[model samples]
Structures are given as structure tokens and as C-alpha cells.
Target: MQPPLIERNVADVCRTVLDDATEDVLAVGPSPTVVDGLVAMLADRENGPSVRLLATESVLKASVSEFTDASVIADLVADESLSLRTSAERLDGPLLVTDERVVSLVTTDERTAGLATDDAAFVDAAREEYTDRWADAESFRLRTPPLSRVQESLEREFDEELAADFERMRIALAEADGHLDEVDISLLAAARNEALLYDISTWGEGVGIASRATFSRKKTRLEEGGLIETEKVPIDVGRPRLRLLLGDDHLRGIDADEVVSVAAELLAAARQ
Candidate 1:
């Protein structure tokens, strides 16, 4: 018996398959773009089934580029909205099996097309094989700390005022997506509260977000661009620490929500 062919635009095919699943979907042999697909699923809050992404070690390594930016996947994992696992044996292309009933295996050309099968025997066999494989697969863990940990650590390591400012900046720019990186957000949040460079950078590194050198580099860029300024705070310790402050007076008094847009305008003006 021939499985019926299903075709959809490559861009939309995966999402549609995900939406159609009941309760849970096992996605095997995912490509790097799986990050983007997972992000989209996370953004949409509904009764859609939670996803389990199973891939090889090599494929997971390649996906680091996709997960480098703001990690929504971390949040999803924390809330049990998603799961990550790795397979020892090589797996085939993107195969989505939902609730051991419907199986959709997507293939890409100019458009995405795949064979779909609901035959009782085939689906049952697939369910049993994948279940065994999943049980044998090692769980994959993300290096970056969960967003909840990041939130709590910020408030504990720093003052609530600074933490609140940081949270505000994060929520304000949640939809900004790629416009700003974590370094920029951290710097901006720090500037709002005149936070210590060492404190923020240390927190960032401790949470596995970035290193001190990366923070320093971004700090220099912001300072040279006139978006931020820092004053030295003399202490009993070895070296004086720099306290971050918003360089632009206009930025100083504006609401925390305006930081992203105003900073973008300033950066563009500086570049030109």
C-alpha cells in the first residue's frame, strides 16, 4: 500500500505538522533550523502538543549557531513545554510522529512534501520502535541557564532596583528579536541603574551567557557610540570598578521600555 503524499510550502509545513499533533510530537533527525521551528511553537500558546527534538551529537553541535541568540527554548524546557534528546544511532530526516496515530515525514525541495501514513499496523510499529529508541537516547541538556535562574540570580546578586530594570528591558524588547543581543540588553539594563560593570559581567558569565571579555567589548562599543558612560568607583579591592550610566540625558529619564528604540536610533546616527 502506498502512503498518501502531502505537500506544503517548506516554510509552513513543519509548523502545520506540529499544530496537528495531539498532546506530544516526537521530531527526529532535526536540522539546525529546528531552533527556529521550536521558537515559533513556543511563541504560540495553545493546546498544541509539546515537542521532543531528537538528533545526533553532530546535528546538535551545528544547532549552537541557531540557539546562540536569545534562547526561548530554554524557557520552554523549564516549563516542560519542550524536550531535547540525542540519539546514538544515526536517524533519518525530519520525521514527526504524533500520539502513535498520525506520522508525517517532511522532505524539502522547492516546496516541502512528504508521505503521510495512518495505517494502523505502520503507525503501531513506528510507535514501538521510536519509543524504544527514545528510551535508549541520552537526554540533551542546554549549557545556558534557564531564564528563571537568570531572573532570580540577577535580583539576588544585584539590588532589586537593578533587577527590576533588567526585567523591564527584557520584557520591553522581547519582541525586538534580533535587533539587540544579550550583551546590549545587559549593558542597557545596567546603565539604567548605574550598576557595577564587574557585578553585571560576573553575573552574565556565572549564568553561562557570556564572558567578561565579551561584555567589555560590547561595553566599549556602547561607550564609543555615546549610548553609555561609566564612572570609576574606588573601593578597598584591587582595582576600581566602573559604574555604568546612560550617556544620553534623553535616555536617562525615559521609561525603560523606550531603551531599545532610542538606542537603535542613537546607534544608527552614530554609524552614519
Candidate 2:
């Protein structure tokens, strides 16, 4: 068999081969442009060949926003005729193999170049390679609308922020020679809530601190160490309840209002 035909116009060759495909089409790459063309070709056919796309996370994400008709892609995915997946590792470029006869290799980066041929052996090799990669690749699910993507990104950022804050608190407490027990950590976490003041007994029990006497002892120690403070607030005809709040020293120069504003923003973004 002659060597595969090398062509610079990758998109055109992909279109021609895809149009001729009678059985199935397998595509592996991170190129949104080529993927877009494949999607368009599949959409135009009345009862087109089965299609499978193996792409990188970045490529999938970009397609959701960049594609002219993402709804059509979603429809294809819903019907099971079109399958999408993401590779665990990056793919070098785009490879398109159709009906186990024609193969196309397209450049993924700046320069547009490709190779296409009806060479059986070359097509077999490409198909086998795609099969191996597809087996290891994770299924790709596209997020709807731009907001869903934004919300996902914000949620990840919020999780990272919370982890960083926990690590910082751990280090700060360790360096200050203030080894916070479980009770202390619980109290601190509760204090970071919107309602800074919490009922000590209720909070302690919720955190599994069980005994009232033990909780009171821990509370007293925290107060003496300048980590927390308490005030008595009277209830209707009942004994005044002690409310716990973070002490001034424990505020770490963070304003309560500012913290609330930041938290609100994070919550809003996550809800979006």
C-alpha cells in the first residue's frame, strides 16, 4: 500500500472521510475545531455512522462554550449515537479513523496539517490506539449554560480556600503553642459561622462533647486563654443562657462584616 496522503487542510479531509463513512467514526484529540467539524457532519447526516470522541478536559470545556450549537451535541449524546470521553493523559493531536479503512491525522496546535489515506494497516493501527486510549479515558459530561461552569469553578475554589484556611489555622495554633483539642477546634469552627454567638451547651453536644461539666471546663479554659468570650442573654422567664463568641485576640485582624460579605459572594457564586 502507498504511504498515507499528507494534506495541510485537515478539516477538509476530515469532512470528506466523515461524509463517506458507512459504519463508525472514531476521533482522538484535543482539537475543538476538528471536533466541531465532526459534530457538524454527524448532525447533518440523516442516520449517520456511530461516533466516538476522545478529548482532553480542556478541549471539552472549550467546546461547551465555543460550539455554535451545543444543544445539538447534547442531543447526540442523549441519543447514544455520539459518545464523548476525556483522556487521563494529553493526546498529541487529532486522529480520525472511519469505517476501519480511512485514517486522518491532524495537528492540534497552531499550524494546520494532516495525513489521510485508505491504507488498511495504518487505519488498523490508529483504531487500535484509539481503542486503548478510550478504554482508559473517563466519560465526558458537558455542563449546561455558562453559569454551571462558573458555579463548578467557584465550588472548587471554595473547597481549596477552606482547606488552606484549615491548614493555616493548624500551623498558627501549633506555632503559638496553643494546641487546640477537638472541643477547641469545634468551637472555633462554630464561631466562624454567620451567628458568631452560639449556645455553649448546644454547640458542645452537637460536636459530641457530651458532658455539660466537661464542656464548661473546656469553655473556661478557652476564655482564660483569650480564644473565646461569653455573655449571658436572658430568655423569656427562664435562666439567662451563656452565648459563646470568638474573643478579640482570636479575630486575627479579620472584620466580621468583611468575612460575611466574602462568604455571601462565595455562596452566591456556588448557587449560580
Candidate 3:
């Protein structure tokens, strides 16, 4: 074992370790900057050293913004050179292990401090510890469209569909003349956002319809008119909760944006 070499700048140590690495590179941290540096190193090689990245969910999300060239990351993954994963638990500090010999510990406090060494015992212990953590981590891969892009696409699609449904609801409300109120609209809007069913009391409170009796009466009317439906959701103890959901017909025919917008307005008013 050798004495660890201290460096004032973590970035310099990282660059040196990565530059000298030949066989493998293992990085664990929540630092977007470090991740970007690794990504750049990988991109520069046609066949870089096999790399494994372990990060927390927050770090991965931050990396999405930091590394705008998502396609490059995807390319590295596709070539089987880079493997990325995320841990639910937060890591203590940043570490970079290269070629089973060199190790770099990156620090962000006071200054960008780092320690590098080729100590066999220290490197082995760090590798073993990281291996265990890696086993429990969830794998992440940067796809062509990427997960964030897919989420944005889904949101846009939902918004467009909801807008169309709101137009229909507007006409229906005008004809009914206060028969269906803001509560009904709020419930419908809530249904559009991926929650198909909700407990009456909880959902009511969440949507700003506080009065139980009023909410119940409105719920009955909506159910009678085929706007929403209810079912019993089984619980481990006590009576089953009454779960409210959009009626099948309403879900199929209505656009969701208008209902959501109206619901938001009603909720805002309630708060004020």
C-alpha cells in the first residue's frame, strides 16, 4: 500500500485518473459536473474503457439538464461501453475507481479537494463497497428519446386531449344551467392526471371541496349523469373506502385540459 496523494483540485485528479485508465472505470456520486466529465471522456474514445456510473435519482435528473447531448450518452450505452444506474439512497461522497488500481475521492466543500492513490488495500475495499451498492441500485439507460422527453410528450398529449374534452363540458354546463358545479369539474380534472380512483374524503380535500354533504350530493348527481362512478376499495382494516373515478363514457369522450384548468381556478378561489 502507498500513501494517498492529495490534490487541491478534484477535476485535475479526475482527468488524470480517467486519462490513465485502460480496463474499467467505476464512478459513484451525485455530481452532475463529474458525470459530464466522464461522459466527455467516453465520447472521445471509439472504444473507451468499460465504465459503470452509479448515482442517486436527483443526480441523474440534474445530469439530464447538464448533459444536453443526450444522444451521445445513448450512443455510449448502445455500444456497451457505459452502464448507468441510480441508487435510491444518497451516497456519502464522490469516488472514481479506475483499472482496479487507482482511486480518486472528490470533495466539494471549502475547495474542490481530492485524494488519489494506487494503494492496493484501499482500492480493493472501495471497489468491494461500491460493488455492494451497485448491486442494489436501479439500472438507468439513456434511450434515443430519453425518459424525460417521453414524459414531456405524454404531458403534451394529455393536455391536447383535455382541451378538447373541456370544450364539450363547457357546452354541457351551459345547457344544464348550474346543475354541474365546479366540484364536478374538479373531480373530472383530477381523474385526467393518471389517478383513476381516489378516496372521496381525501380527494375532496385535495380538490378544495371541503363540505362532505355538498361533495356527496354533487357526486351523486355526477354519477347519475354518467360523469363519474364509485367503487369500494378494500382496506386491511375498517370498512372499504369509497373510491371515485371518471365514468367510462366520460373518460373515453372528454378532453381533460378544460376540466383541469377549471379545477385549478376553483381551487385557487377556495384558497383566497
Candidate 4:
């Protein structure tokens, strides 16, 4: 019913929301920084209220970091008693925030879904929406420790695979000084895009809408096939630093087009 302790300051907004008496809160947006703050607040034993967040798959992937104990949030949603829920949009941008007293629904136009309803109706609607979402959402919560272990193993495997591909590409290019066709270079770049850097998409649906297993598998396959390289970068931000990935270095100081032409010339001569 009141303005969401509103502020442009993301941390302050989260602190105010978390400290409030409101037992339930819904945030709709694609900002991972805000979501991470909210999750941190909720994860707090003293200040955080039970929180429900809804947004699109792309937003979640972009925002949620892999380091947080996402399983806790997942467990709360799965419990059914806490009445917390999260939703993901197939598209992008804007988010929705609702509590017992207020709902801030963000939209593509940078406006939130503004709806006026009684507290009772809001709760009922949120609950109904959450229930429907839960049914459709692929499980992002993993309680099975073994599964977590398996996921860790898969991640390592992907990392190794990506490294191998990088090495192979480097060797192939070095043998002929990286003279390759523009088309071939473009193809490799496209493939390189699949590498799962330290960003949130690797966390899968728990952070947004894409299926966790699906994102994980796709990223893993890219890594294992040696098409990418993953590493860790340290930062002093909210969460600890994370592992990241980068595209293969095609060649040092060589223009993309020049490399392609040189490679094509070699190939044509060989054919003759």
C-alpha cells in the first residue's frame, strides 16, 4: 500500500524492504544486483522477510550470481507454506515486485505492471500465480548433494574441454600463422559465444526462467568440447568473485579479414 521504501539506491531499497514488517514481498525486474541484495536480505536470519521474485529467463541468467546459496531460496518456494514464488519471462528487461501491501510490476516500457487490489486479493493472486508457475517451472532447487557434486564435476569437465579447444585452435592457426577465411573466423566466434563465463546464466532457472538443467548442460557441452575457456576473476562486490570465460584468441594483431584471406589463398594454391 505504501511506496516500496523507494530509492534509486539498490542496496538501500533492499535493506528497507527486508527490514519491513511485511511478511511477503514480490520484486519484478531483471536486475541481478537488486535480486542479489534481496536474496542476501532474505537469507539473513534476522532482517530478511520471505521474498518472492518474478522475472524473465534472460534477466535471471544475467543477474543471479552462481556463488549465493540459491538452494535456500528454492527450498522456500518448494515448501509451499512460506508462500514465496519466482517467475521468469521468456523475453527481457523490467521486473515485478509485490508485497502484502504493494506490487511494483515492471514492464518493457520501463514501467512496472501497475495494478490496484486489496491486500487479500494481492496475496491470493500472488499465491495463485506462484502455484501455477511452480507447476510449469523445471526444478532449479537441488537438495540432492550428489547432484550438486555431479554438477561440480560436469563444470570441471567443461572447463577442460574448452581449454583443449582453445589449444587446438591456437595450434592450427600457429602452424600457418592464423591466416584463415572471414567465414571460418566468424563461425568460430559464434561458437565461442556459447562459453559460460562466470555470469548468472550458468545458474540456470533458479535465477530466472531458463531450465537449470538445460542451461547447465548446454554450457557444459560447450566447455567439454574445448570451444571455450573459463577462469576466475576476483572482485570486492556483494558476493565473492566468480569463474569467467573468454573467447579464444584468434591471433595477436592480425585483422580478422586478413587472416581469412591468407588462409583462403593457401587453400586455393594447395588445390592447384
RMSD values for the candidates in order, in angstroms, are 4.9, 14.9, 14.2, 14.7
Off by over 4 Å in 4: 1-4, 21-24, 43-48, 64-99, 105-123, 141-272
lDDT of 2: 0.57
Off by over 4 Å in 3: 1-12, 105-113, 143-272
Write the residue-wise lDDT of candidate 3 on 1-272 in tens digits: 33454555554556557667786778888477777666766676655477788998777766653222454566677677778899888785578877556454655553454456677787788888888898888988553433233234433534644434433453454344343444465456544443333343344454333456666776666566555667787889997766666665425443553443343344344446
Cα lDDT tens digits for candidate 1, 1-272: 23544545433655666666676777777776655555565656655678777888777666553323235567778778778889989787677776645544554544555456777788778767777788899998777666677788888998787777777777766656455666788889998888999988998999878899999999999998899999999999689999999998778888887887788778878989
For each candidate, the alpha-carbon lDDT, in order, equals 0.74, 0.57, 0.58, 0.42
Which lDDT tens digits does candidate 2 get at residues 203-229? 445433345666677667666655567
Give the candidate order by descending TM-score. Answer: 1, 3, 2, 4
Model 2 earns a TM-score of 0.45
Model 2 regions more than 4 Å off: 1-12, 66-68, 105-114, 145-272
Superposition error at 19 for model 1 (Å): 11
The candidate that wins on TM-score is 1
| Candidate 4 lDDT tens digits, 1-272 | 54333454444445554454355555544366555555554454443455555555554554322322343444344543123223553522223333444434232322223333347776577656654564565433333222233244434535554334433443344344333421233223324434333333443333332454554454454445433345555567764433434333432244433433443443455456
Q: Give the top-scoring candidate (lDDT).
A: 1
